[model samples]
Target: MVTTLLTPVGDAPWSTEEFESRLRAVPEERYHDRHAFNIRMHSGALSQAELRCWIANRFHYQRHLPVKDALITAKLPTPALRRMWLRRIQDHDGLEEGEGGIERWLRLGEAAGLDRETLLRGDTVLPGVRLAVDGYVNFCRLRPPLEAVAASLTELSAPDLIRTRVAAFERHYPWIDPDGLAYFRSRVPQSRRDGAEALRLVLSWAYTRKDQERAVAALRFACDVLWSLLDAVAHEHCPEGS
Candidate 1:
């Protein structure tokens, strides 16, 4: 188990410490880092084609990150919060063209033998992958800002995941250009910084037991989105009955 909640839900409101404990438990238990495809990926078991499929399909999700962040950014009540969240959008979209996380991700695609135009064209994206990514975007667009931020808490596990990816790619997938790993390498510190701020916001905003539970549920939904997207990719390529 990831964590044993110090306090049970449906009781009185949890103390801030206890509520935070619950949120921290989420990624430990539910983050897609534990997905089977990821397990195989880290073990250097994926064929080049399998790995490239992932790079191409995952771009479908990456390209929309700014769009999702922008939706959440607009709902922030304070200029201070909005300003802080705007950095997230800028991190992906960049201050000017031909920069930022999105471009770096395209370079990763190129290293994986996928052309940038093909990644942008979205033709390689599986139907389930499309649905999962779109669902996440819509989740931010419609849910309360608190829940949306809660969903982003998957970043809590992202730093370590990114690190593992960089190491694994360098060790296992020598066919890919090492420079193409810039996306994962840069994300290590970026995810930690982003996840910490997002966690603080969740802890502060979810002041009541109900709100805290909603945040937990939202994080669970986030885990589901990522896991489902991987399922789509794995189903298409992994050995039958895997």
Candidate 2:
């Protein structure tokens, strides 16, 4: 089975640099690229119906992204930290409809022919999808600040995947309106901004060896949460061996 906890209470201890190496390892091994959904999405192999399911199911994820950030923001005691992190919620939620990442994802679903009712009601969402996302939120809410920030490190690999996804959609799924891919487009700048800040936060605050290990563990768990969700979606929605 894939490793879940980074270092439990008593495993080998990691130094700060070792922790960084482990941190890098988490995404390298467990990032969404390893996921079957990503492989199909990036290759444009999914049918339109599969694409619709992707949008509908992933809409749940988009809804929770900001909420997770808000949870983290609520935890920060300092105004400066809170102020810096609060932008994430705004970026995802946006000022109004037809804006923000969530809106863009909805457009993608519409372009894929998903009805608003089914999409909004989340009637088609897989149980594992909700579990993985909830796991992420709970981790942020319950973990130490360093670990929570480290968990956000999944954003590090997002830009590349976004680019690949857009390219695939443009090439293979021309029937899809270009506007629907906005979810990936909007994520580019926001992911970079949030990821850079999160990386710096984890590196700076995780001073001790044990703290660094915890931070790495946090990141690995976050990656698993995301990767596993995509896996669940793919298994449930995608056709045989897809």
Candidate 3:
């Protein structure tokens, strides 16, 4: 019989490469890209209603991204880190009204036939989605800055997922306006840049073995939060009997 042994945390201080590998490994095992909902989405198996529900539910997550970033920003110890991290806020919130990723997502909601006002209202957000998204925000708020920075390393896997999603949208969901795809298109490059910076910060800050373990644990928590969000969406929109 074969049994798998868990890799014990705090075994030793990881080299930069090893630490990065451990961080990247979380996505391999737990990224939402592997979720059943995303697989169906990529395969074009989701119905239009299902797609709309996903957009509406995911908007809650998108809207909270800046909030989480802000929490992380508050924990940064240096002005340089704060300055560097502030761009993430600007990327989501923009300099003015009618701009930024949030606006683009509202357009996506409109393209999906949802009312922009209604999506913003968020009355339809699932309780589990709320818990998952809120859990992410609170984790950033409460954890050590290094762990919070590590949590954002989930961006490392995001560029690939965004690329796959963009292709899936273009190939299968042509009913959505091309303009509505701007959110995913914009994220491809942004996530790459952000992920690189975040990985650098995590590698620099988590120099001790226990610190490295905490960073890895933070990243795993983020992956689980994202997976839970999708699980909630799947349970609601793709129930087994249906």
Scored by lDDT, the top model is 1
Q: Report the lDDT tens digits of candidate 3 across residue range 1-242.
A: 99998667647688888878888999889899999999999999988878887898899999999999999998888899899999999999998998899999999888767788888888678899999999999998899899988988889999999999999999999988888989999999999999999998889888788999999999999999999988888888532111
Worst 10-residue lDDT window, candidate 2: 233-242
CA deviation > 4 Å runs, candidate 3: 1-10, 238-242
What CA RMSD would candidate 2 show? 6.8
Clash pairs (backbone) in predicted model 3: none
Q: Residue pairs in steric clash, candidate 1?
A: none
Report how far residue 196 has shifted in candidate 2, in Å: 0.7
C-alpha lDDT (0 to 100) for residue 12 of candidate 1 = 73
TM-scores, each model vs. reference: 0.93, 0.88, 0.93
In the range 1-242, model 2's lDDT, one tens digit per residue, is 79776656555556556666778788888897977777887787888767776677778888998988888998888999999998888888888866677777777887776777667788888899999888888888888778888899988888887888788889999988887777888888888888888887887787666788788788889888878777777778543212
What is the overall TM-score of model 2 with all chains considered together? Answer: 0.88
